[model samples]
Target chain A: MTVDHEPVSTADGGEPRFSTWTGKARGWALRRLPPDKLLPEGQPSYVSSWIYVFGMGAVAALVYIIGSGIVLALNGPTWFHVSSLGRFINSTHLWSVELFFMFMVIHLWGKFWMAAWRGGRVLTWITGMLAFVVSIVTAFTGYLLQTNFDSQWIAFQAKDALNAVGIGAWFNVADLGQILMWHITLLPLAVAVVVALHVVLVRMHGVVPPLEAAASDAQLSSATPNPATESEHRK
Target chain B: MLGIQQTDAGMPDPGIYFQWGDFLIQFGNLVVIATMVVLFILALVIPFPGRRSRK
Candidate 1:
């Protein structure tokens, strides 16, 4: 019943614990993302613009969607199909998804107009797009799991198209077990991973500056071209 | 029975108090399709009337 109070020492005058992958990860993270840069209290002044806020809104909506989804999942599938309370929770999840999609589309369009890939933000941009694609796939599988007339019609009508393309063999929406696993587990997990990476990249590289600000700043910097300033703002 | 069973969803419900309450819900499919079509067209031709949008 006694717990050991002493730390384990390595045999060869060095600790294996400090020299492991965990230590390397800690060092790498600290070097790449210090706490102040990772989670800043004050953003750059240019982020004050209205267009920059939609990304935050999308993240917020995603949080709500996940929270509601967990609640609904805990209640099981039949409750949401039949009970009033479950129906309300289901509706909340649905509306949250609608908001998530709306925010994502607006954010994507705004970033596109901003030419947000300027400098080294290409991976940030791509991950966001990939998250959207994953979310759409998740949503489609969700529709298949609806257990309603809508789901029925979608499977009935779309099965031919899918089979013709050979996708139906692998991703059979008509198969409840397959689609449900995808809806509840695989797709959502993929989306979460991609979204996490997207946010980390955003935090790693600070929010992109406005075109005018970047242009003026570029002009002020030394004549040597900074990769960040290589953008030609469409005038 | 397993392949194409129909559910009671989308069937008309008795709405003595709210006759037209389901109108929007009933027609939402068409609205969604139309909206997608419109949005796609807009995306293709948007930032329009110039070489590139100044914004």
Candidate 2:
């Protein structure tokens, strides 16, 4: 296959001749995450601890969950009860979701202790926290969409709780269409977007150094206005 | 059976529960929480392959 080898002509100011949207987007992306850092060949030695793996583990489990979910969606919700293959995929999806939550919670705990938000990474921490909240809502909707006795009972109980809080008036747990759409579409999309942002921020900032390192640095540079002590200095 | 149907659905198994005043949690959930705590500790202590721990 032949591909265009010619580059876009440049203006006198060195901008692309046409200033196409793709060119601008590419420039913006490169500015945000340069090639070397975005796909680094190595990380800081402190990142060798096993705790660092949980974030990637959560992401891997999410991949399996989405893959199995696609299969279940294609076969329709009830097909799992009737067919062996569908049942297998359903089981895969359920187990993957369980792993996803387990890994994500572990990751959250690791980050909390490490204060992973250090060094201008507060947005990373916020995005991760948002992903966890969105994921909980997604999982709740999934439970409601199970189409079983448990789901029916859960919906009724949840309805009472939501009504007590006055949320049931606007968000009906008993409404299958609403819950199904939330489970299959809206909540998942929200989770995906939040998780993507979290990963991008992590990549952009690089993994945070261990707490001891940061503490020693703060002590060494007590007079300096580094991120670790900037807030303390503020007060 | 259209979807995942419980074998006996009178009331789903309310697994073992523990309560301390107002704080209550199911046994299974407690186990999950405990396991995560243990895993976090282990992850902190466990060394990654081919890497020496920084002094």
Candidate 3:
């Protein structure tokens, strides 16, 4: 018996098919470049407050940390142990991380207190918080990758505690090489993915208003009675 | 997290290993841990009146 087979089209075919990165898609990506900067033209009128600075400040610190980290990586971990320039860069990177965590913690608190998660924004808040938690783990691993005396001591200490807690098999903090790869690759990628999702959610939901106004509006509408008032009351 | 053994083999002697760096590291660690504790307490204790209003 003879079997018939369908022919597959190739480049030689008369008509050309465009790739996913075609003009329209490329334009869409470009228009959405720097996801966090989507509101460059204007933020919502309700986005006023010094509290908002913490989020931007955290991003700035992350930028500095990544840039300085790249320089340190180029120098190699051992360079910081022997070279003055490398040491300075390492110190700067360390301070940048400290500031990054500090700002992120404050930003998280501010968001929580403001109840910024309201109005269909819970996902953004949760994603950003998860990103923060992942960044902390990444930082911890990076510290282990330093391969200095401090790194060695911290690794042994942390390994002991983690082993006691029964998670030692999954994460070997003493594996400097593996930890370095995770710090430079996996962690950063995870952080980037979560941050992208966070920005998308924020844009879709828009910035939440201050609690006072939102509450007053809720009370005012709730005090009145009607289907429209009920909807407004539910706000 | 890694291998766990009760033996103290390869562990540096705490008595002979004291240094300014170790002191600084310990002090810094304590400070960070303390700050986090305080912040966590404040987060829970402080009345989030604003959030109630917003809702």
Best by lDDT: 2
Q: Model 1: runs farther than 4 Å from truth?
A: A1-20, A215-235, B1-55
DockQ of 1: 0.05
Tens digits of per-residue lDDT for model 1 on A131-221? 9999998888887788876787787777898999988889888898988888888888898999999999887777776566655564223
* Local distance difference test values of all predictions, in order: 0.71, 0.79, 0.69
Per-model TM values vs. the true structure: 0.70, 0.79, 0.63
Which stretch of 10 consecutive residues in model 1 chain B shows the poorest summed lDDT? B12-21
Residue A124, model 1: Cα distance from true site in angstroms: 0.3
List the candidate 2 regions with Cα displacement exceeding 4 Å.
A1-24, A164-166, A214-235, B1-10, B53-55
> Chain B TM-score in candidate 1, rounded to 2 decimals?
0.41
List the candidates ranked by lDDT, beginning with the highest. Answer: 2, 1, 3
**Poorly placed runs, candidate 3 (over 4 Å):** A1-37, A164-167, A215-235, B1-55
Clashing pairs in 1: none
lDDT of 3 by residue, A32-149 (tens): 4445445445554344445566677877898898898888778886797678988899899989888888778877887888798876677888999898899989889977876666
Interface root mean square deviation of every model, in Å? 8.1, 3.2, 7.0
TM-score-best of 1 and 3: 1
True contacts kept of 2: 0.73
